[model samples]
Target: NLRALFGYMWAHPGKKLLFMGGEFGQRREWAHESSLEWHALGMDQRHEGVSRWVADLNRVLREQPALHQKDFVNDGFRWVQRGDWEQSVVSFLRLGNEAAPPILVICNFTPVPRLNYRIGVPRGGYWRELLNSDAPMYGGSGLGNYGGCEATPMPYEDFSHSLSITVPPLAALFFKPE
Candidate 1:
């Protein structure tokens, strides 16, 4: 099960989980060890949606200068939150040096919608939507609004303010400064 596998690996240090296709319980399985069933794509749109979501996620992990610029666990990696059932969301922050910009990454695992959600982001001016899992390109039903991003104020954590946004069901989002 992708859910069980993900939770297990998420807790184990230095362990990574890779699924063959969109095996995150979108309601299907890989067929007879051949090529990906392009037709089975019709059985469940969540498969295509979640697959694109994961692909975009990998692209972000690989290309984002702030995320890949240094060691993830060392420089700015921090688990800001978690939930009881472990069907939870997580957050990460990437702090900048003298010249670069700070970034925030948020992931959600809830099967239902999360609204008016707030998180602590580094103090800054406008932040841009680096990527969103709810976008139509990912096969999601596209319940998200604002194709781009709006301005986020600074000092948003204590020294920060409330960072407000909505998280569509089973989605992830990345943010970078504009």
Candidate 2:
């Protein structure tokens, strides 16, 4: 759940901030007197996974212009799927300048795995899965789209292109055109 929350924050528009103990999934309350639980990373794999996931999100934020550029503007974000309350899934696209490729972010709030979930995209081509919170390294069940999914011409939502993807339970997935 921490991974998904951070993923959504990174994908959402505007600035970013992380509380002191959030990077490594600190279990205890924050205390200015005591130092961060650095030993937690070595104690559990899940803690290390959260740290690694935060690092990746930071790297992606720096490397991908679509994530940071034009974040303060309304045109930088677009909704691809936001009405699926029954499935508890929401997907959106983040846009940068004209030169940068748009990024698609999907978040599944439910604990049940959602298979064959179709999401609309602006273009039709190979959409590479840049990050999957459900991967084994992230202490998840290793359920994902196997690195990427190809967008087809079949129109499902408002867009002409769509990709059939497997959304892991209580996880978020990030993709970009390749």
Candidate 3:
């Protein structure tokens, strides 16, 4: 659920915030009176995996232009699909400056997996999977797009190019042109 939320937030402008220890799946509520339970990571592999994912996302946000550049500008974001509330799914694009290509983010908050989910793109190329919350390492069911997929000229969601992607159950998938 956190990954899905993060994906949704990444598509929008302004800042994205994560409280301390929340990124690594801190089970207990935080208290200002004490330090975090650092031992949880040692005790559970799941916790470690969550930490790794958080680190990866942080790196992506810093390194990817689409995620950071023009974040405060409304032009930095665009919705690919937003009427699928019934399916608990939403898709959007995070765009950088005009010189850079956009990054597409799709989120499936439902527990049902969606196959052949076609979403619009701003360009045609290899849509590399920058982040798959359903990867095995993230304590997910290992469902993913197998690294990347090629975009087709077929228009979808109001865009000239689109790509068919597999959206894992209760997961978020981030893609970038490569």
- Top candidate on lDDT is 2
Give lDDT for model 3.
Answer: 0.84
Error of 2 at 80 (Å): 0.5
Q: TM-score per candidate, in order?
A: 0.66, 0.98, 0.93
Between 2 and 3, whose TM-score is larger?
2
| Model 2 whole-model lDDT (C-alpha atoms) | 0.92
Candidate 1 ranges with C-alpha deviation above 4 Å: 1-17, 22-44, 80-87, 95-98, 148-162
| Candidate maximizing TM-score | 2
- Give the clashing residue pairs of candidate 2, or none: none
Sliding window of 10 residues with minimal summed lDDT for model 2: 81-90
Model 3 C-alpha RMSD vs. true structure (Å) is 1.4
| Model 2 lDDT, residue 116, Cα | 94
Question: What would the per-residue lDDT of candidate 2 be over residues 34-108, giving only the tens digit for each residue?
Answer: 999999999999999999999998999899999999889999999997579999998999999999999999999
Give all candidate RMSDs, comma-separated: 4.9, 0.8, 1.4
Q: Each model's C-alpha lDDT? A: 0.56, 0.92, 0.84
Model 2, backbone clash pairs (residues 3+ apart or across chains), number: 0
lDDT of 3 at 168: 97
Q: Write the per-residue lDDT of candidate 1 for residues 114-156, one digit (tens) a residue.
A: 6766666655455677766667776655665374345455444
Candidate 3 residue runs with Cα over 4 Å from true position: none
Kindly provide the TM-score of model 1 when superposed on the true structure, using C-alpha atoms.
Answer: 0.66
